[model samples]
Target: MSIAVAVISSDTEYVTRMMSYMKGSPIYHTWRLQLYTNPERIHQLTELERMELIIVEEHLHSSLLRRLQAGGGQLDELVYTSKRGAIPIIVLAAERRELLEHELYKFQSVSALLHGMQQRYERFRSGHAKKRLVTDDRQQTIAFCSTLEQAGKTVMALHVAALLASKGYRVFYCNLERWNTSDSFLAGRVLQEQAASYSDLLYVVKSRQNASKWLAEHAAAVEEYSFYMLRPFQHEADRRGLTTEDAQRLVAAIAESGLFDHVLVDLPAGLDDWTLPLLQQCHAHYMLLLPQPGWQRKHQLAMSCVERHNAQALEELQHKRLLVLSEPYGNCQPGSSVSDLESLPYVEAWQQGDPVLLGSVHYRAAVERCIQPLLTGEKVV
Candidate 1:
């Protein structure tokens, strides 16, 4: 559900500027914009195209103000040509633009006007609309990390995302390893010789004065999977440049965009201050440890990570699991706290570079079942 806003101004420059700015903006993802040069043309807009707000020029607003003063009803021609209840009309006035119980805004630049409009739109929607909570609008993050590499963390992360995506929930696969694994998972689609991978997304997030517009133009997604993946950064500095806060803001921004229902992060095999923010936010944080000879060492590492961080801060996440990928025949106890799953099978799809090759594995169902509670915040469906 996208919100529509109309801008009716006789000043041709302003109308053209508004259209130009709105076209490739992230606001477009959440808003539909209509531009009208003549107030009389308002009636020509269809009901489906009707606006939630009308940003009118001063001259046009003065005319409408006089009409309203002369005892014009809500259906008057000056009233956005709306046939039903009165639509909120905001005037772009230069003098004493403060509405003081009126609907007028004073703005200098086009960007400022849009920003003011965005703020007002939020207030209006919050007050008058039956809208979902902001928290509900954001995607839930499911983080995958472990103390050692080849703990089957990446495979688990990929399959969980793939399963959710297969179920028609918009899923975004985020690889937060120090070195990007996009080429491994998304070689054909999410990479290039000098691809502007997640670095671009990060750059826009950290620096874009107009982040919504920047993301609309720059964020890259795998269309086939109905998900987005950042291109792998070429230089190590680019990867290291990100602070923990940067990672936090990036994930939050994407989730709030309402583009994905789930964000599955494949964290590298380790824990540090940099990873804690993400780990803390994950609804289901899983530490996958394969039953190799050094299993105890990895388990100790994970426990030490909990100790190193604020255990009290993480008390709420204690229910999160440490999953063991045991074989059909393994030495581990059957009733141990670690949930066991069958050994992973070999997938030849990688020879052809398919991004979702992990979805075909036999053990995906077990992975899905393990995280189903986190996905739904209740019993598995």
Candidate 2:
């Protein structure tokens, strides 16, 4: 009952190095790993003899892929990576901290490993003879990030909706700021639905201005049901405490919906009075920072606030999240380099800038354009 692995690599150096590394590891003893670069040779192996996992480097021939696809047996996994841009597919990795935008974009083209592995394996283990019919209530997660300004959060929410749509998940992008101040397009409906229960669940709050209007305008395709995107409150909080209750209700509704997958909370920038409670509710947090000249100071300040709020045993936060350094926008200063930021252990660093930031206005504009794609899982490039 030994598991089998197939390594298909274009780079001789990489293949040699990885094989050397694997041979020394304990996994090598339990799994039968075969190296292949020839398609005809692979066909000779029987179904049972076929490798369960295939690690193919970029530049693999199409004939090889078609053959593999036609094999019709269970393909437990496939790993595609390359030095050049030949292979453009990715499987999400929790530990993939500094992966480039180009690499991240590959996930869209090549099916996500989560879909291939976790979802499928769960079906197989459930005693289903064939593939499980994926239902609308399946669990999923959507990530959202934005700068401190009004536009950043708004745009981030829209992009998140777009991403969920792309993935065939039901999604609703709710921007509370745009709900109905009489300044925007959402001021039509005035219906009240009392006794609505809200916890960590995602639900639709009736718009006071225009219910039908907004629904018609913002209703994403059914596939977008996977997530619901919402903008963080700009005022931070009030004497009545609008954000806390609103957030609680939203979270509760999302948890109860059984239809919505993830409720991506796009929070305001800097250390706000209400940031802690919100962070506590989240399973993970993405601390977005700008790489200004004084970024070190800002980074430390942001980290301190997070530390104080999460306060776990021995200076650790139970929620394992990373600090994502976004490009600077608005009046904020430009961000520091990734290499410079990664030096900080308390933060997992990322850079969304190209050619670095030169000035305030230029950097702000750059930041705005840079993050637009990230909201919807689009690659940075």
Model 2's lDDT to the true fold? Answer: 0.39
Q: After superposition, how far is residue 208 of candidate 1 from its true place, in Å?
A: 4.3
lDDT of each: 0.60, 0.39
Q: After superposition, how far is residue 349 of candidate 1 from its true place, in Å?
A: 9.1
Q: By TM-score, how accurate is candidate 2?
A: 0.41
By lDDT, the best candidate is 1
Candidate 2 off by > 4 Å: 1-38, 43-154, 174-240, 243-245, 271-273, 313-319, 328-381
Instruction: Estimate the TM-score of every prediction.
Output: 0.54, 0.41
lDDT of 2 at 54: 46
